[model samples]
Target: MRRLRIEGYVIVSADGRLANVDNLMPDELKFEGDKKFFSAALDQADLILHGRNSYEDQPSSPKRNRIILTRKVGTIAPDPSNPKATLWNPAGASFEAACDHAGIGSGTVAVIGGPGVFGMFMDRYDTFWLSLAPRVRLPDGEPCFPGVPARSPQDVLAAHGLKPGEVQMLDPEEDISVTPFRRAAS
Candidate 1:
């Protein structure tokens, strides 16, 4: 089976109340530290998966294949500048199949997103890489993961047959925080 990974950040309460997407991204997220790590991770991804709104933030010079999911956007035939970038519409079957059909068959599939995308693949994801910017607080911006009842990462993992992997302090110099969770070994 293909290895599917969901990697991104979300804000939640200690008891499990998650912030909504409409309040997630804001001027406060402009941390140089978080930016560095995010860029680094993007470089490491074999293919970057993103929703419509998230795709708008894509860097001009991407080092890996970029697979954008959208119901409205049609195929943007490959160009010299975007030889590996393509927009996919996951009509129904697993997004994994969409990725496969788009030639994103192996390596890490980074699911960078808007909340709906995350929620759609949450249960099927094999791993999750999360970044926590404990310092930046958005008073009225959008939330990270929205909709559905909020649940701690642990609870969500258990429900999806996933398990905690390792929590690391990324970019100690910049104080960027991150954690990685993998599906329980079978």
Candidate 2:
């Protein structure tokens, strides 16, 4: 029941890790082609949602409209660091209300990563773009989603009612492929 559409985007390792144990995305996993696709997708979104740690702190981030998921806030608060960002607690306010408070009415919301933020939108994602680096392996690393390393990322998505579409190779030399999973129709 959100009025606005939600799409999740993430790139995982062969073993289904989003980042290494230290919560740092390894350089080996970054591919130019995959980055291009991810960037383009976010560029089209009306709003971007992600947790505090996931914020890149890039110079351009302040200009991008975003919601920073956090428990420190009781409900909704303007992010002190970024003029266009809002600190939101999902438990305190509904997604729509949060968007309304942020001045974004109806449009695509790109939900970016870090496990907790990604897992919170499991049942709500209209589409989840999963790009995998098949040759990269990071054992005992942070999972891309909940139940990941123990259970495959595909299993988690299927359980949440999302089905994968055709895989497109983003980088053949890097052996990276991206799959867009859509929620099944009722």
Candidate 3:
């Protein structure tokens, strides 16, 4: 749409949860291998996009350019807390415009998530890395994407035209594996 390659990164529990009942990711769901893979992938992104509540604090966060989805902003505004961050409302402006405003002409855009954020870009992702923590389960917890359980993360991605790639096992003992779902070629 704007000469951009959009990709998503998320870790879900056995029941398709991104977080616990309290809307926070529990420590049990965190794994070292998934962390390393996610970090490396994020390092290569030209821009990072996520919802207001979905930030994962990392050492490179301050320096990384980010477009934060927020309902507080009428259009696009500078994020006072972070110089590298911009607050954007999709209701007020288009994604292409928001990217342009953020000085992101084109490159890889890493869409980190919360369910609401993930749902917004359903039809636009070029690839989405889905890391699964098979041993963990967050029953009645926050879903990885909207309509999860009823519609799995895989089903959601598939509906958005992305087909699953080969699954890569990140941790054998913990049964953690990641799948890169690429958009099916039209």
Residue-by-residue lDDT tens digits, candidate 1, 54-78:
7535473355777767776443333
Instruction: Estimate the Cα RMSD of every predicted model relative to the unseen true structure.
Output: 4.3, 1.7, 1.1
Best by lDDT: 3
lDDT tens digits, residue span 34-134, model 3: 98888888889999999998886878778889999999999999999988888999999998888888899889999998888899998999999999998
Q: What would the TM-score be for candidate 1 when compared with the true structure?
A: 0.70
Superposition error at 133 for model 2 (Å): 0.4
Candidate 2 error regions (>4 Å): 56-60
TM-score of 3: 0.97
Tally clashing residue pairs in candidate 3. Answer: 0
Error of 2 at 67 (Å): 0.4
The lDDT per prediction is 0.58, 0.88, 0.91
Worst 10-residue lDDT window, candidate 3: 54-63
Native-vs-model 1 lDDT?
Answer: 0.58
Off by over 4 Å in 3: none
What order do candidates take by TM-score, descending?
3, 2, 1
Candidate 1 — which residues are off by over 4 angstroms? 1-24, 56-61, 73-82, 92-97, 147-149, 152-158, 171-176
Against the true structure, what is each candidate's TM-score?
A: 0.70, 0.94, 0.97
Better by lDDT, candidate 2 or 1:
2
Question: Which residue pairs clash within candidate 2?
Answer: none
